[model samples]
Target: MATEALAVRQAVPGDFAGWLPLWHGYNEFYGRAGDSAPPASLTEATWERFFDGMEPMEALVAELEGRLVGLAHIIFHRNTGLVGPTCYLQDLFAAPEIRGRGIGRALIEGVYARARAAGARRVYWHTHESNAVAQRLYDGVAERSGFIVYRQDL
Candidate 1:
């Protein structure tokens, strides 16, 4: 699928300047509302890892006129008991003003393409239940699995 106006591609180190805003916007949408600091060193390491072909983690970005408006982060992990490899879409965020303009769709489609290339049978992600707008988009692209995920901070 060709994204004409929205260019979707793997993120590079130099893209961090563009990514930072979109990333924060995404986190804010999740109700982590206030500014949260991500160490510069860790952010640099993430950008480096995405370009490191040896790593299973990957990231994609959507650019319009050389400005980033959206991004997607994907992680490949093996599932237990023959569940096979799964691609988890860790994050998907688009600038609020740019929402519904295909940037988000392009980001998702790019993740699907990457996951397919990696031999993944399925791709999955989660969103806050109250995020109806996002859920609408997600519903159009993929089915919501029946299981609910739980976690506890160790």
Candidate 2:
């Protein structure tokens, strides 16, 4: 499939129905399904943030033949080391059936364009070390930061 046929653009309210499945799949890929799935309130808030101008978050969707096949969510924030805001690609996912047709690449390029337009100096994201497939795509499009990730549940 020619990536040219894929339309990568800001997601609209109408896209929620199509976007939810991909969002769930992304979570499930990381073992966040069922008992560990994110709460509905959090999901609802995330969606609302994308449309709120006061928020620093945004969402992009990839549509092929009018069906959404992928999604990218980004956040822009001030960084102590950067003069300009940095763009963090919080989440990126393409449907399993359409993994290698350039949907992921196209959505990433879309994020880059958006980040550049937003006066961001850089764009970055993280993936589970075990996700070699996604890493393959990430490696081709962006450099590995070589930083280990750590977290503590509040």
Candidate 3:
């Protein structure tokens, strides 16, 4: 931040080189260590979509000295009884070494800005029940809905 080093820009195919590690790190933090990531094919497809200009998925990367240090993936989804599509923050991550250095905050703030620009009625995301580190930051930036998420594979 000495020189305002972080720049959040729309991700492109070429950014895959910088984003893959952060993406994997994000997944790992969610407790998926092995065979837990979206298939490589899906990752490839996602990279392509980020630059397609027509896809609803949007991603931004935070770069410093031309190196990607953080990322945020966002999407708009329909919600019944909502006045407009809700903006969901699908993922947010920063390099472990750079965490608490405000990079993660920057990525999330960027997501908020994108959502507002897209005319979204609201923006939100969920973290694991025990993710204390993320919760600390989430508590500061947004209100907790007190909802417990349930998931079933297959």
Candidate 4:
């Protein structure tokens, strides 16, 4: 499909039904699947955050032919080292069949645009080491930060 044919916009309340599967797919891609799925309460809370005016979290969706094809979630937060806020491209996913059709790029670019508008000095995200395909795209659009990630569940 032509890139021009795809529309990227802020997700609306009406988009919940369409966005659910895509959200699940994104979690699944990150190894959250079947019994490991996030509880409904957490998922619903995340969904609600997008519409909460006081929340810094936001969600964008890409639609083609009236059907949702991609989703991107971003969060704006304070950074001690920077004068402006930092924007984190938290989660991004394009439908499997439309993976290489520029959907992801559009979503990332959209996030960049939104970040800039929100006074964010930098926009960054990470992918699993195994996701070479996405890394290839990331490598083209943004430089690798050279910082490794560490995490611990409290």
lDDT of 2 by residue, 1-154 (tens): 6666799999998889999999999999889999999999999999999999999999999999879999999999999999999999999999999988999999999999999999998999988878898899999999898999999999
Q: Each candidate's TM vs. the true structure? A: 0.86, 0.96, 0.90, 0.97
lDDT of 1 by residue, 59-78 (tens): 89999877888899999999
- The candidates, ranked best first by lDDT, are 4, 2, 3, 1
Pairs of colliding residues, candidate 2? none
Model 1 pairs in collision: none
Ranking by TM-score: 4, 2, 3, 1
Model 4, 1-154: lDDT tens digits are: 7888898999999999999999999999888989999999999999999999999999999999899999999999999999999999999999998889999999999999999989998999999899999999999999998999999999
Itemize residue pairs with steric clashes in candidate 3: none
Off by over 4 Å in 1: 1-3, 33-41, 81-84
Candidate 4 contains a number of clashing pairs equal to 0
CA lDDT of each prediction against the hidden true structure: 0.83, 0.94, 0.84, 0.94
| Ten contiguous residues with the weakest lDDT in model 3 | 1-10
Model 3, position 114, has a per-residue lDDT of 87
